[model samples]
Target: MANFIKIIFFLIIVGGIGIYFLSQSPKIFQGSPQEKVSAPSQTFVSPAPTSYTSPSLSPAPQAISDYLIPSGFSRGQLSPYFEKINISASYAYSHFNPSEIKLSSNLSDNEKVNITGWQIKTNNGEIIIPQAINVYEPSGLFPQQDIVLSGNNYVNIYLSVNPINKNFRLNNCIGYLQNDYVFSPSLPQNCPTPSRSEISYLSGQCQSYILSLWGCKVPDKDSDSFYVSIGGSSEEEVECRAFLDTIDQNGCFRKHRFDSDFLSNEWRLWIREHILDSQHDRVLLFDKQGLLVDEYTY
Candidate 1:
């Protein structure tokens, strides 16, 4: 009986040991193969950039009305013989063409006359002459000399002496004398002629051979018109006319329409031939008929 009990106990101990070994084996050998971690997948994309710009500006509008004087009369300096005259435009635009004034008096040679008052009438019947005492007289004449009317006015009857020659002869007088009592024509506003010295200087320095090649002369009939030429070729003639029109008193010409060569040549020629160095610059004095009465190139 005792042997039987001991055998049973031994078998029980052996079974317990086998069960512990089985549990421990599973814990030590059951782990799967180790796996390596991979970095997150990435995509490269370029970013869009913004652009900047500045605002644009607009130009202002120009004015429309233009002031223009009548065709004749030395716009300003209308003598003070007229009364109650009103100019068509403001005095600013009073560029009168001297030829337009008409004289109504027949005078003996060297006769003295007295001018009382005068008036200025516009083409539209507008009178601009102001009411004033005698404002003009021959340099040597008395204070009460003949009435000198300027602008577009019909001169009243009056007797006056021949300021220049002092010849006592009756003449149809329409204009006033400068320093002397001769009825010479009036000159344009600015004289365009060049003195001899000016011509010499310009000829020596200017680059345009054509400019140095040309000649200049005063106009016979009209004080405002002048002649310029390089031996009278058709091209040269055309160029001369174009140059005169450019420097005309009216200032009406398109600079861009002319060629660069033509402008340069004309400018060089004008500088060489027309600019005066002396005290007396060439000037145009007009008569009542807008004719070149006298020219002084001092």
Candidate 2:
């Protein structure tokens, strides 16, 4: 009986140790349907870059031809000659002076004389005559033995020698006189001869006159008067036209006329009067006391 009990005790102890080991072992479960764990889905996307382009440019308009004058003529050198004469005399004549000579027959009353020589004496009492002529005129009567006259003499003379210069003073004088009346009809009664500056401005008119006395370019709008661009710029056409429209209520652009003739001394006086008035308006002021004041700023 003792041997059987001892064998039973050994069997029980072995069963107990097996139970302890089973409790301590890691437990692996049969994961409920083993849900397929897929790697985190990765999505790839591409972005577009922005594009840029330059804008096209337009060319400037060509200038008008009518407003343009020939530039080459502006710089040209024009030399106009008057008259030059060399005189030879065989007769033994005494007491010769430019004043004593009958220039009344040689020149018109309106004509002027500008004499320069070894024999001439100025009205200012200056002796411009050279020493060579002084020796010839020891008696003071025969001032110069050999004399050369050079100037614009208004009259026609039958010269021993036909004038050395064909372009004589007569032609120039006639041209000046004729055009003077045509271009500026409102000229003064004692109209001064046209100078280089006057001729330059009036030459275009003279040329037009030569074409036809009445050949003025008619305005596009059929007006008797028209606007003249003093600034000489076609680009400012819109601005210029607007300015003209503001000043001209009558539609025709006539110049503002003064009370006196344009060339008279009275005209200058009138200008002075208006100038003072304009300046007074610009600088004058009124005080609170209703008195006139000269100060520009309050």
lDDT string for model 2 (1-298, tens) is: 9999999999999999999888865443324356555699999887787754211100111221323212222211111111111111121122121111111112223432232221211122212211112111112232332222222222211112221112122211122222223311111223223234523433353323222312112222333233343235554444444433422112211221221322121100000011112112222222223222111211
lDDT of each: 0.29, 0.25
With a 3 Å backbone cut-off (N, CA, C), the pairs that clash in candidate 2 are none
lDDT, candidate 1, 1-298, per-residue tens: 9999999999999999998899898565656365345689999988888754211100101121113222243334222211112211111111221112223322223322222223223222312212222322223342433333332323321111122423111111111132122232221122233345533433232214324322222222233322423325565455544444433212211222232321110000000011222233333233233322222233
Q: At residue 116, what lDDT does model 2 achieve?
A: 29
Best candidate according to TM-score:
1
Residue 17 in model 2: shift from native, Å? 99
Candidate 1: where is the Cα deviation over 4 Å? 1-101, 116-192, 202-298
Candidate 2 segments whose C-alpha is farther than 4 A from its true place: 1-116, 122-124, 127-170, 173-298
